[model samples]
Target: MSQIIDTSSRAHLLDLFLGLRPDTLSLWGKMEPQQMVEHLIDQVQYTNGKKIPFLEFSEEEAKLAKQKNIYTDLKIPKNVIFGTLPDQLIYPDLPSAIKQLMTELDDFDLYFRNPETTAIHGAFGPMNYKEWIIWHSKHFTHHLSQFGLIAMT
Candidate 1:
């Protein structure tokens, strides 16, 4: 499954984005392909240890969320809205948007080299590098499935 965090699977995850085009239609939601890519960039940006924590989950709730989301195979339900995406494109093209997302994802390597580094996920509170990887795996899966780039498992 693409949910695995190994290098090969992560490469495959990025490859999924490479297949996206500007005209690609989502099965649900208002986000265009580039907007979705930009949305993903927003999601990844928080994991670089820069964003302030405004956790949506309480201490106990975060534990339950991580247990179900990070440690298990629970899927993000279809059409689950975090917020409506803007129609404006961040990058002029889908490729450019995806490239920026890739750059942001790679920055985690440097950010987590300290091993003590941690980041806040709005729903999962503070998480470590490995936790973020698993969170990202499922996150990419959810978005990719929305565009039918990958099957919903």
Candidate 2:
């Protein structure tokens, strides 16, 4: 099982975002910049009140995401991966998405102080809060790295 991100690691994730560019994400996934942004926005929405249908997983999908493998380490399943890029950037107009995600993350960090609030996998499965954070951080970073937004300096 993977560890979840705690308050201490939030800063690290924020730091990772410092120099992110929209272009670098192209290399990691087929989605275009706008699609990538929209994808992330969807994630934020999921975390917030907007509930999308849980990603239905086939036997292969479940088998692929095993106990040891972090979510970021696994390839995005074909079912959910965007098929086509949008013509325009969607997130810029939806600043609330970013704000909501940040707010939820902040709440998550604060909630962690009460050990009872341990991370619980939403639709995926069991995972500590730290693991959830790491998964999200890594997942986002992986895409950002793919797009050429953030590079190892």
Candidate 3:
């Protein structure tokens, strides 16, 4: 069995977030600070409760995912657009978002220790808890890196 995400790594996540100065993020895209924050928050919410609409990939998208090995260790390329709602999409406040993400991440860590908890990923189909953890870690890190928040130094 694989080790789960360390929920106690709040300091690491916080450090990453704090390292993100506004100007560095602005270089990524047109998103405002609040919008980027909301985007991260929405990801946590979607994982915790709502089943985001999963679309059958276009041939192009599927080919790209396969070529890029999205299901494996490859990094999601920068500016390789997929589908997500605009950051203007309404969600809970920033504090609430952070709290929710923390709670869910903790819950996921616990779930990883149990054998029965299964997660249905949007693109990757069914996944065990360990797989889900890797997916979330990579996905979140991708976004954080995109925002110039964290570098794998």
Candidate 4:
């Protein structure tokens, strides 16, 4: 079974982000390094208090989708467009954007400590803390691979 490198390995993960250069190239997709980092930060906010109301599937469909996503080894498909974020560059640079992403990740952990709290995902419907973490790991792995920082085997 192929396993994702979990985001809990924060130090190593941060190293990959820190290594991104201004001229880094993506294997696919149009997002620049800083833009991608900001994009990830926006997505991570979905687990905290961000209220995204879109759902890609019905309750039963989302349930099945969630099962396949979280319990199985499905990698998040690549080359997806995000309509939520504008063409704006939110952070001054890649390192700063990555730093902000880590802050949001820390907030995600704290936000879900109540356990009773859940957040909506446009595709997966609602998920608790642990589910979000797994999803985030997969999400991060996908983007990291896009930059050739890691390979999926």
Candidate 5:
């Protein structure tokens, strides 16, 4: 299982972001390159304890998440509803967007290193630090694959 909190996987993700071109097209989702980066930053904000989730999950949903281990899945299914990115965080260019997301990812990594706080995920319910790591790794890979940076096998 590749983990975004792991140094190697982290570097791989960062390199992929850095390699993104402005005109890159998504293989599935509707987001442009900068929009994808901003969307990731929004997700990382939740992981970093900077945002509060409005959605709540039932115990059944949480238990199902654990049982299914959905985060460990290799692909994010097409046409899934992932929601929208906020207007404020969208960058004017791809490099700026990637830089912002990279910073957020670094902050997330630091928080995971000495996790002192807990946050609720909108769908997955309560997740510990390790679960967050696994989720981010898979989520990052899912989006990276959107731009063909990570090949789905």
Candidate 6:
């Protein structure tokens, strides 16, 4: 699996994100181009422990998700809702959203460097840096494919 925490992988992901134009259409999801960028930034923030999730799964559910290694999975189920995104995160344009996402990506990189830091995913429960990296890679790929930025094999 490609890991997003690696510099080269991050660069590749960034390239795909930058390749998106304002009119890029989603292949699956409902998100527009700017909304997709915002969504990705929110994903990064969730991983970095900068934003708390609204999801409150039952103890048993959390345990099951952890046991299943949900986030680490290469492909997530499509059309799964990720809770509500903050209204403030909605950017005025794709370029602005992309720029903010780039900043968040940098923040995620710094956060990942500290092995001690771990974030609790809403569905996946608490995750270490390695787990976060894996999740982000899969998550990014999923959305990138939605925008036709990459293809899933």
The TM-score between candidate 3 and the true structure equals: 0.65
With a 3 Å backbone cut-off (N, CA, C), the pairs that clash in candidate 1 are: none
Let me know the TM-score candidate 6 reaches against the reference structure: 0.81
Task: Give the per-residue lDDT digits (tens) of candidate 5, residues 100-128.
Answer: 77788788766667655656777777777
TM-score of every model versus the real structure = 0.88, 0.54, 0.65, 0.89, 0.82, 0.81
lDDT of 2 by residue, 108-130 (tens): 56656655443333445544556
Query: Which candidate, 1 or 6, would have the higher lDDT against the true structure?
Result: 1
Give me the overall lDDT of model 1.
0.78
Expressed as tens digits, the lDDT of each residue in 1-153 for candidate 4 is 265767767888788888788789999988778878988888888776754557778988998889999888888788887575466898887778889988888888788889798888877888887888788889888888888888866
Off by over 4 Å in 5: 1-8, 70-74, 85-89, 113-116
The runs of at least 3 residues in candidate 6 whose Cα sits more than 4 Å from the true structure, single-residue gaps closed, are 1-8, 70-74, 83-89
lDDT, candidate 6, 1-153, per-residue tens: 442323227676667878999898878767778877888887788866588764468767876876676444446666777676455547778878888888887887787787787778787677777777667777777777777777665
Give each model's whole-structure lDDT: 0.78, 0.50, 0.56, 0.82, 0.71, 0.72
Candidates by lDDT, descending order: 4, 1, 6, 5, 3, 2
lDDT (10s digit) by residue, model 3, range 1-153: 122223247777765655554455454556654556566565554454444535356655644554444356676556665665473546455455455556666655665566875654555555566555566666667667666665632
Worst 10 residues of 6 by lDDT: 1-10
Looking at model 6, the pairs that clash are none
**Over the stretch 76-97, how does candidate 1's per-residue lDDT look in tens digits?**
8887887776756768787888
Which 10 consecutive residues of model 1 have the lowest summed lDDT?
A: 1-10
| Model 5 residue 138 distance off true place after TM-score fit, in angstroms | 0.8
* Candidate with more favorable, higher TM-score: 2 or 4: 4
**Highest TM-score against the true fold, candidate:** 4
